[model samples]
Target chain A: MKSVPNRILLLLSLLGFASALTIVFYPLFKKPIHTSVASSMRLKIPRIGIDAAVESVGTSPDGAMDVPQNLDDVAWFNLGPRPGAVGSAVIDGHSGWSHGIPAVFDNLYTIQKGDTILVQDQNGITTTFVVRDVKTYDPKANASAVFTSSDGKTHLNLITCTGPWSAIQKTHVSRLVVFSDMEK
Target chain B: MVIVTMVMTMLASFASPLIASAATTPSLGSAATYGILSSTYTNTTAGTTINGDVGFTTGPALLPGGTHNNYGSGSPYATAGSDQANALSNINNQACTFTFAPGAIDLATDTTHGTIGVYTPGVYCTSGPGAASIGTAGIILSGIGTYIFKIDGALTSVANSAVTLQGASACDVFWAPTQATTLGADSTFVGTNIDASGITLESNVGWKGQALAFGGTVTTVVDDTITVPSCTSQTPIPGGSGTAGTISGGCLWTGPNPCSSYGPQPQKIQIAPVAIAAVPVPVATLPNTGLPPDTKNNTSSVIIISSLSALLLITYIVRGRKIS
Candidate 1:
């Protein structure tokens, strides 16, 4: 009778040991997989009280970078590197919304250097970037540097139309660009 | 005794396969220094600026206009040429995670896109002898992973077509075309072109990568700008370290080669499966922490089970001794 109880205990302990080992090594045997669903990403600027969805935007028919259809959301330049990638990852939002409704980057100009921006990817990994510089450019500025980075460091540049509204151009006369680097 | 033996066997089996694996990036070696490395370099335009080293075995050594280190047919040039060949070979050997159908393959159309095709990092290839072209609509390469486009035939881009990078670096993007590569006029291109044949840059082309031709000439027309991409760190090649043998020279761009020692290596981003068709929805609820809840639970459960097992084993041993 005593041996029977001991046998059950031994069996239970052996089962527990086997399961613990299985759990410890399971991830190693499993293949790591990822799917690129750009919509799964989110952008948050705590300083500006901005937490908005990020939509992948491509080039328009006129060969210019496209923007999000909804003013509340921002458009990620899908044609360039991702937000946390090695090159400059660009995200553009609208400063002015119709009916004076709140927009994603309405207060983008208020963002000062050293501000923190968080980008959450599909896997829920949040990449933090620190604001480095803030610059304003003419509507017709070359703006090539806004999309490309040569220093090989990861960068995130936020763009929103700023300055006085341009009635002739049907857009803002100046553009605001917030340059940020990936926090080490 | 039998149960203990069985548990020990299970533990050994599980622990024996606990080998760790890491992803690795392809080393460019000395060739990483050049914006244009070719057998023969020809320039028809007067105001072309190459932002990196320019090397050729045979050609006019003088560039029409640019502050660049020109390497003539010498040791450095020869080393770069050999390095280019090795890089091309390493690229060719990579297994294609995604393969386009045979025929004239248009990358802009074959890959999924919202307005333009946005490609994640992976080995994208064309089967058989099919030419690949980026249409006038252009294509976007988004993500940090290594992108290797292996074209079995010629590669061409339409005029004004732009290869945009979202968060992808030009340094991590590689293009290996078996035949000649021609960039349309005024088009913006990115990534290193290791073409088996020659590479031709039309007028007013802006290239943010290298043009490395194996044996053919690399020609640039009027007002072409070629800049070598500088990568401080790169996403490792998926699966394992690439077959590309390690070469010595580090990042060579003009400014401090921040990538000289290949800075902090980021986690390898795996290629997404190609079957996803629907447009990515804006924002889904994401986990609040870096680790998902399920993973945390699993980890906790493992720890608990391990503790319990150890305790039970000790108790069993003690009880057995007491009974005896």
Candidate 2:
């Protein structure tokens, strides 16, 4: 009779050991993902103190994407997929004024790694993104990374004029683009 | 057909080394034209001499007492006049495309020259509120490589803010400042300076490259010397076969008569190892125990729970043996 009880205790201890092991290992396994595609309507970045409405824009007659006339407003490439969609979406703003004044993205260069970027769509759904990389491109260079479609994952690229001002061209010398990946 | 294919493959194998060697130097397009170019006006004090052309296309103004040699229609600059415009455009286009080194030291907040080290060819930038200042100890750029310093903010040089070069040239160094760029008195500098707003060369600054202000304005104090690197010696062959210098030791400053102290002189500096990114812990290779990687926080809890269960099992077994 004692042996029976002892055996039951041993079985219970084994079950307890297995449960403890499972609890410890659960996080190592890949977690299930909950993701969806939605049209981005508003963008917010608390770290950068940016909360702005997004406007849809298309390519201009010169084959370049049209820019927002208002410096504060950000223009999104309308021809591409929405921000939370299965591909890359682009948004751009002015970093400085033609007269050497500060523009909307004057402080955008202050962003750091691991900061969160929130994008809300017309449907009221929000997608969160984590910054992965920040890069600057010459105004006249070809930047396929900011525009090209990527089916592998969803990304959001924010761009603005940066670098030295060109008196001859009356424009910034380079463009600064911040790349973020959608958080799972 | 088989023999021809084999021969072609052999030729390609032999050419691989040549191609690899040629890839090190990046091309600077039309940007190489001016030793010093300004859009509005160029102002200089007496005794300021420029070896290359001094141009202000927009304002067509240059301050008196500064001599500009080796530019304009009669000068020997390779890309002068109309060709220079294209070269500037080319440099503006290509310069931004290159990959800047990661974790570039923030030299802006450090108004006082604090950084001292040897840097390799790559884009160094300052994104902070304060302008980037080349600290007092100065910086040594090593290797015959291209170096681009892009300051989105303003740029200030303290006195004796020296820029020493190893195997580099004035033509290969580029300084792009978004706002005002001021060189302190008696500061030594290298590279073509493309300042957007304006540039003020403090008294007696020794500049070894072009000082260009896109807005067409450059202000130089008394006794500032600007030497433009010569085109014949500055231009690198397409195949990277020959350099611009034919001097016995190395290519000295480019000009009809090379300046004695103007070229890159050898310097000793401690080169820091390139920063390596942290590798993520592998999940797939973990033993099928299905637990998260044994990080310190996770391991602590796991060990406690495991220890408790093991103790209970041992107690049960010991008690059972005693009873038996």
Candidate 3:
């Protein structure tokens, strides 16, 4: 009788334990789709950011900003893909600043060929673009191609402060502008 | 209290994976945002066209050097208020041409709804196999101050002739297998593993920007890995975040190139699964309903039986010894 009871108890306990364990570990099995969605939300790669407050406008006939004679306190946009009322979209940023990481334009100083840029509208629609060339010129006799859109194509212009940093007033001697066309 | 706080901290740390999922979803939206150049001055005024011509963004882009060429308004290549002059306009009807024939160019910023053109150190209305086959060139006579020129149309600019910039820099339309939706001097692009064929770069040719492909976005998939950004696997990054983003090769800037970081930009992650330790998941606890708490008798019974079994075995062994 004792053997019988012991045998029954052992069998019952083993079944009960297995059930208990399965219930506890059920979460280990998950939906792959759900996992993928979760993974995407995570930042797998790092990216860059510019100012979100600059006004949006298209290219203008004479929409280019006047280069300050005193390069000392230049005021302009620090992001590309400017959205003005008309003309090619313009976005400007600072190449470097006296303090801090400066602004979005700080990275403009390192641009090279074959780069792509994306500009978005207030509604979150991105306008893709690519790099063609770099230009460095004296502010005195600045050219028009830097700001103008030849072939009347829609493009994005990114401008920033360039040249050696000034110690006294603290500003770049020359301003840099990058012109890019809208990517298809 | 300290123990309780520590426990709580651990629990929260364990649950953070569930908390970081509140960001926005990346999706490739529609592809239909093109701006108008002008009602007139169109090369082939047939269907919509996008011209990617200008390769350089420099001060004094260009000037009209010949007869009736008061294009820069006067001051040569770049003069007072001539910053909008372009290198090439709708010339030769080369659809999608971003170049000019080295001459006087007009910056129609003031001529609202008119054809506007600009210049640069490279070929104006510069054409090539890939660039010329698409988008039409135009000089719309639009009202000035840059009214149109949006980047939504099917337009692009590739290098036909090489352009040189500052002594330390070279310029070319190094067409990567991938193209960007936008371009800029502040941005530079580097093609990884993806062989950039048929595209040549000028000596010391340097640029900064995100690498973009004209064909929407490209992505490849293998047995266990999905590479690049294919139409099915990758979605378009949302727009207007205004965050200076790195599109791997994404940029749209002009001279004195606005972008600063040119060394080695971010690299593409050959996405593959990695083995990781599995952790237990949190579960909901059931409420304990008040009831008569009965002590479990099985354990106690087991203990007693075990003791009895041992005693019986010892007795048997002693009996056997005595018999022998």
Candidate 4:
């Protein structure tokens, strides 16, 4: 009877050890979720632990897509279709350090394909989006595809500055874009 | 009184046909091949497709997707620029058959053609310091002749507005604006717009003629399609198959020559010059979304996950030791 109780404890400890190992390496084998959202007021990337506010923005004086003034927030291009609309809706965020604080998209480059992005609106309804592609572009590259979509499906694209910094230009040399599609 | 009424009706009918005379068509010359001709052409989105040639003199013309003969300050480009200047001058010098004073002018409703907005071949002028606008109701070009619109100020069209052609050719339509010309989003415009101040096209604007901006930039946003009208003898007159008569110059038409009848000229309205509001030009660059480099790394999640894993492992080891 004593041996039987000891065996049960041994099996339980072994099971616990296996569970801990799996938990540690779970991200490596995890499959990505494919989904998308509508009429966004907030952007949530559960994988990177980002839950940031979204602000509406237009073209800047220099005719570029404007970014949010706040480091913690993302700016949605209001001139284009709204998030979850038929066309491609663009949102831009700041990356790098802002006054010793991490900006909203500091870890944007770490986002992987198939990640789930959630957009929540004022009505408390949440829309989900799945990552389709991640691309890098030159600073002077024609980024029309980021703002326009002809497939007649709702799309959301997130943009952030990546690559090497240009001290003279006061901006990044390249841009990182995350293209997502609204879940059907 | 009955005789007087019959005579008045006869006079009105006769006067209607003589309201507008055919305006002279200015030759585009080498500029005819270009859908977009400017000193600098700037396009933001990759969706813009120019069906004809695109020429620029001073350019970093960032056009990514389009099937066209792209020219930069050489050969036909320089010739096209000169031809555009000449065409602009010719159109500007043409006498106005009807002029509308600036404030609150809609081409569809405010013109002499009244609510019908059907304009015959003539030179129409909007004497401004004020702007002229085409509302959503739009306007129709009715006959086969040169139709020139001379706006001393800015010209803008509302979204979804269409410049419809009835029995006219798109090639014969010219818009000469002294200031900037803005075609609103998704608006379908049919004309050869010659502007000294610049041309800005909003998203999805479908233009069937040329955007010739002399000494100015031509800026296009997302998904604008500009096709240079190929004016050939076989150009079909939409509703002019049966009753349509051929003019002496081989131009086919459906209606009577408006200038053939005798009538008094229409009164022209002159408005005081108002100062035009300057439109902001779009610069060709992407947004600046990067911050300065930081030494601090954002690895809070990684730290947390690793710590949790270590704790789980420690717990399992301690429990196993106790069990043993």
Candidate 5:
């Protein structure tokens, strides 16, 4: 009788283990196809009071994304996928507070977690996204993270220069990137 | 004692470099100044049209001056050879030692499969044979930044599998293949430096970037066009990010080169601005900063704690059996 009860207990434990493994690896088992989407035109963030026009900026002849000449506009990398697309859409702006001039992303560093960002496309379709990550890299940091797209989810990464402003380099000492994910 | 050993093992795991997935991209240094640079061998066939200057250092006899009349003779040849030597030294010393950013995608993840479609700027590396290849539709590289394809094994492109760029300058792409690299027939490619052991370009391939065989040799056929990017107006600061440093050379467009008549720049679109709501000051205090949580370290910690719990449970089971 005791052996029978022990056998039943062992069977129950094996079933529990199998169920736990299935729960943990469900995402890997269920492969989902993620399709790439189109370009975005407008960006809205209610939490930080950020509503601005986006300019389609191409790569500078020097290989970096061309910065928006106007401080009021944000430069969107036109070559990459649009915001809410299958890949990561990168947008950059000046965080200039130098020479007494305030730039578009001046308060970008103050963004909080869970903040909502809304992106609108040319076709009048809007996608809602939430702040998922924020990171800072030194001026010499490998910026490849700003461009990688393996997760298959739409990501909008906003970039602005932070840290000490170097007059010699004519840019900041570091770059601040805020990562947001599309609301599923 | 077992508990202590297990704890120490877990601690050492956290301290191991292999546990970290991030690696930084290496800087190219002075090597970025050249179009085609070879250390040991540089030669071209009769029909080969080289738009850029070619150079070689350690040669069995002499590096072959290209069929191009203007660039192959006299002063151009000497200058190109010397430049190639300097660039090769810089590459072997600087670029080879440069740290790589954490490579996210394993180009040979499937080993048998090849990657296609548009990709953003980043470092893609592979460690095995049949690592990375371009398909018939070809692969497009988007963005205007530094992109590195570090292949520890061989790199080959299928026929008609073009490697195109979107808004990026060809000079920004760097292909560092540890083994031989072959461009298939009729494949169009853009990029600056290719630090490889041996590079072979098949017939009828239009290449906008330079091929630098830093280790072995470069073979190019007459029907193939390898135009070194005359980055006259565009400054190519390879490796690092942000502002580019100033570089000096004869960069003015006095005449047309291979890619000069490409086209006008793409137009920029202006979108109307939307109204933004006023930002509110936070009233509550939070311990954690506004950045993403440190999930990597936290996951390790969770694993360690779970293992300890499991060990304790096993110990309890043993004690119970002994009592019974």
Candidate 6:
């Protein structure tokens, strides 16, 4: 009889442990989203822990989109609704050149759908985003606004290279983007 | 009856003591006959004059615009010359020197300088490296004991060329093509550098975007004294007054925002200018560029959801006995 009660208690404890584990890892998989502050945080590109190459390239109005040589090459700025609003948040780096990671967006294309991304802001806070879609675009193409959602939805659109490598310009004609959404 | 009629007639003829007395000295914008400096003037508050240079205690005001205005000093400036401004056009086609018409404009009196017409038809700034034919050399204001370089024009940067702000005073500006509506009366594009320093959207001045977007960039000079506020979700309006200004959509100031939400970093605004001070450099001592305003919607909703989740978690744990 005692064994039976103890067994019941053990099962309950295990169930509780599983629940706790689910809640703990929920942010990495499925987590509750709070639009208020989550959407309010600035969606920053450039992961907090990842070390990116800083390149130096000439300046252009189109900005260092496909090609960048240094931190100066990549025009760093914000585009999300607020700083850390959910949805797909994006920060673009140069892909043409670099010293460490060389390509501004070399790893961007490597990011598979459902991958997790964290954006750290000026307050040392991190807003997480998960990859959802990856789209490719051409430089001359006027489709950069794809990252912007019409319904006040915030998203990060990352731009980079894809397809067979080219020798003439050294890269492909079209650009690939890894689209992510706020992990909810 | 005749006396009464005369009095009424005189009143009508005299009008209400009108201030219009001085006829315009010159046509507002482009000069006739191929001129050296061509520009445009766009003013949201019609009749706000782009005074020629304010009287400087020292030498000539840099670009013949205005003078000695500091940040938040309420110094009025001219608008981006609407049509298209070719300050030193043909720098590529022709051999002409172009300088960013001075900005430290302080409209002590209603004045006008540079050009007086529409400028740069299409976008943010007149797109060009002047065709790269303009060469790398650019205008530079070397010395100063307080001077002004007023520009009611867009200082567009070429491929190799850049517009440099070297004055020691606040270069008050009134308009940018994207932020101010007067530039694009019937347009459907977003203007670049809307966040350019000294830019403010007054009385719904520059509100239109490609599709109702807010968030333009402005560059501000920093100093050791600038404070870096903690990042928060709080959106503080630009000016102290509520009605006068707004937190329009989203804004990213050079300094850190204390009301930031989520994960924000310690954006040290003063660091930019302060870091340069250590270099013992001249212009290097100043912060080079600035940030643009960020945007979107749904941010508030997302925040709400985050709050509720936290509350639920707190309540569940607090109300229930300890579940080891």
Best by lDDT: 4
Model 2 segments more than 4 A misplaced: A1-184, B1-33, B57-115, B128-130, B233-324
Most accurate candidate by DockQ: 4
TM-score of each: 0.43, 0.37, 0.24, 0.45, 0.34, 0.29
Global Cα lDDT for candidate 2: 0.57
Error of 3 at A67 (Å): 9.9
Residue A102 C-alpha lDDT in model 2: 42
lDDT of 2 by residue, A17-39 (tens): 88777766664563422111121
Q: lDDT per residue, candidate 6, B21-115, as tens digits?
A: 11001111111111111112112221111112111111111111111111110111111121112221211122112232233222111123222
Summarize candidate 4's per-residue lDDT along B190-279 as a digit string, tens digits: 979998699999999999999998578998998899988875422222222211122222223223222222223323233332332211
Runs of candidate 3 with Cα error greater than 4 angstroms are A1-51, A56-87, A167-170, B1-324
Error of 2 at A44 (Å): 72
> Chain B TM per candidate, please?
0.64, 0.53, 0.16, 0.65, 0.49, 0.17
Ranking by TM-score: 4, 1, 2, 5, 6, 3
| lDDT score, candidate 1 | 0.68
- For model 3, the local distance difference test gives 0.28
DockQ-based CAPRI category assigned to the predicted complex of candidate 1 = incorrect
DockQ of each: 0.07, 0.05, 0.01, 0.14, 0.02, 0.02
Which lDDT value does model 3 have at B191?
Answer: 14
Q: By lDDT, is 3 or 6 better?
A: 6
**Model 4 misplaced regions, further than 4 Å:** A1-184, B1-21, B58-64, B102-104, B232-324
Model 4, C-alpha of A81: deviation from truth (Å): 37
lDDT by residue (A1-184, candidate 1, tens digit) is 2454777778888999899888767655654222112245689999779988776555555555666656667777654566876667788876654322446677788899999999986457899999999998775566667876666588998887776655455665677888999999
* lDDT (0 to 1) per candidate: 0.68, 0.57, 0.28, 0.71, 0.54, 0.29
Candidate closer to the true structure by DockQ (higher is better), 2 or 4: 4
